[model samples]
Target: MQERGALLEVVVLHPRDVPGADEGGADRLFLVNDIESGGLSPEPGTVSRLCRETEIPVRVMLRLNDGLTTTGGELSRLVGLAEDYLSVGAEGLAFGFLDSDLEIDVEVCGYLADRLPGVPWTFHRAIDSALETDRAWRQVRHLPGVDAVLSAGSVRGLDAGCDELVERAAADPEVARLLMAGGGLRGEHVPWLARAGVRQFHVGSTVRPGGSWTKAYVDAAHVRSWRMLVDDAVDHELARRTTPYT
Candidate 1:
């Protein structure tokens, strides 16, 4: 990854959205077959197809099911899926699991990290479920293989918690290394989020046409609009950062 302030354009794409995302100029892709349950592991063929089809990088979700917490068996399955995804040429992996007390399951996450040291890893929003989020996020930030955090701050969603997330990022340059702002982001939110030190923005259901609530389909135009909005936001943020203060 680049330094704390570099822009990373990432979009969560269902298998159905590949063509649209590709045509619409996405910089990278987070491929998930099951978007309704937050996100989950995708089919091996799906990963392979995306890797084969898209020149941009691809990352796959590793959660076997929806809930943030996982059993030992379920974690193993996640590991298995991670391995499968990497084998099929996924550029990175995104996932997280918590223990009963809702803290980062260090043992589990560490094991996954150790299992795939060469590839990049992102601790997903499941970190929001951490019982004491501040401590949990701090703990995970120091882990050996964690690269980025897909977070909406500590609260349930981005709108309410983004300022807190910005505070956390400003407090810790390490967290800023890959602090990706996501969760219910629309085009208008990009400029503000960019100003708050969010270097990456993750868009999911809203990127579809007909809107996420109306069972929107994959429309390249939707992705194109998002691309334009995000680019404008990043450019403005960069200019603001470099401007001389009189």
Candidate 2:
């Protein structure tokens, strides 16, 4: 496996968004439910199918709601679902835990992390919802067994403060990192983010139907388009960086 902050790696949203998702150049698959609320949580069967079939590593993210804060029962349910997914071949689990105050619940996250062995775990974007983003980063960086945080850095906009996020991750050694730059990311912005020190990225629109409320969802050609965009961006960067200057 490549190091955490390698260079411009893509993580597709849901399996459905990218039908032939496994074949794409994405480094990871964040399995979720494509509900009206924005996040995607797949059924056990769906996760199993992707894990059993896909060659790429599969990571399943469980959310308590459209935003942060999860209940004990909900956390348990996620753990159970994670077990099921793991048994069927899932490679990682993506989730976040927050206390009643809505801050990162290191204790609770540690509990869930303990339950999951071998499979890597992502703190998810719940970090972006904290009352304070800087503090959230500090707390999550200390969480045990956390593989990375799938965050856009600031809740205001994924692209707005990417430099801050990248700098924070780069400075923290205790925190293994993956700056999952998401939201408003396109073929054009891919290079900008790469140069900004963001190595990992998340893209969904290219795989799913665009618009907040499509009412009528259809083809997910966006996934293929996104894959192409990221692939091209990586190829372009590789060539540009490797060229010999005369």
Candidate 3:
């Protein structure tokens, strides 16, 4: 079982990975398709089957094409797709939007949030690619139903962005609370992130055997190792919080 107060989310590209992820202690599954395109939306039938099979909460991706901008008939199509995913039992959604200027496209995001009133969502890595980091964070903080903001602090992922993530979390309480640290996440990053107050973690190819999204399946043992690493890190952070100063 995963430790309380921390979440370990694993990506599921196919239904076959479901049992191993669930059995290996994933708290939730980020269901997506076409990993090569950085994860576009999955078909509703796929979502339905995975939702039916896995007890873990499933957050389906809502992007139709590569990049963050959506407009015209594409927006309409996405709204309908959102409904389809919900109808099939998706517990949450993962999406992000940016204008041509590379800023948070609040209008588009708000429109979708309005249509799906109570559904929780995550603002994905588009925040890292925004024109300004602080401005994007400010915009997303108030968006309705956005329970988390997935970021690696830079577009380049953890190796380049880890320090920035730690600093941001320490400086801003809301960022810390809503931040779901991910993108090239590794075991060493877990302890630092946990200590900095990140309670949620997302893993993609990391949980797969040989870390190959196409060649290898998600391995139960690999997932379990991540579960243990995150759980232990969170446990230690909690202990440190309650420990008396010398």
Candidate 4:
């Protein structure tokens, strides 16, 4: 499977790190307030700050809590919050949900996307948690307003699910617009992941100085190195696709 140029998303834990993320040449900023629960939406103030200060795209996660079961009043509240974030100028939204059976809640997810009208959305990491990965994509990939799916391919992570990703990418290059490879993705892994059909690379922990574990800062220098590697790999892949084969 040949790879296309991927959009790089760098996670920013703090609003203050926004500039550093941009300086590192990030294509998008994953503004997060809570990482332990996957991630949560940033404050409206933070969203406003990023909007005012940065030129790059910024997406705020709409996760209300840590768990996957969002429903009833909680779901309603999330809807209102989505409007608030959009009103305050978030470039896009990211959120996830699952039914009691641990599947993609298409009815619920469809409503969420429909409410936003024209805004771009990401179906978050919930897809990785789904029991039926194939079924999940079949339903949600083409859902209105969903521009991407932030997944590691399977619950285990990119490396474990590379084969599934490779297959999916081959079946539908348009699936979720992009099968963004996140979770444990790094520079060295890019070439193989690309060959496995993954086109987009996302790094949260990797964007930090000590790989988002030993440190809590978005190291611009570290990001620059990753940026170089990602751009080079994407370019090389595109070149490969264009070269005439024997």
Write candidate 4's Cα lDDT for 30-139 as tens digits. 88887876788777887887777788888888877788778677778778888877787778888878898988888888888888889898878888898887788887
Pairs of residues at least 3 apart in sequence or in different chains that clash in candidate 2: 32-40, 32-41, 33-40, 33-41, 34-40, 206-222, 206-223, 207-222, 207-223
Off by over 4 Å in 4: 1-4, 213-215
TM-score of each: 0.89, 0.77, 0.97, 0.91
Which segments of candidate 3 are over 4 A away from where they belong?
1-4
Report model 1's TM-score to 2 decimal places.
0.89
Instruction: State which candidate has the highest lDDT.
Output: 3
Q: With candidate 1 superimposed using the best TM-score fit, by how many Å does residue 228's alpha carbon deviate from the native?
A: 2.2
Clash count (model 4, backbone only): 0
Query: After superposition, which runs of candidate 2 have C-alpha atoms over 4 Å from their true positions?
Result: 1-18, 166-176, 208-246
Q: Which model, 2 or 3, shows the larger TM-score?
A: 3
lDDT of each: 0.76, 0.64, 0.91, 0.77
Score candidate 2 by TM-score against the native.
0.77
Looking at model 4, which ten-residue stretch has the lowest summed lDDT? 207-216
lDDT of 2 at 212: 32
Query: Candidate 3 on 162-236: residue-level lDDT in tens?
Result: 899989998887898899999999889989888888899999998988889988878889999999999999999
Summarize candidate 2's per-residue lDDT along 40-97 as a digit string, tens digits. 4568888877676566678886775776677778878878888888888778888886
lDDT of 4: 0.77
Model 1 error, position 27 (Å): 1.4
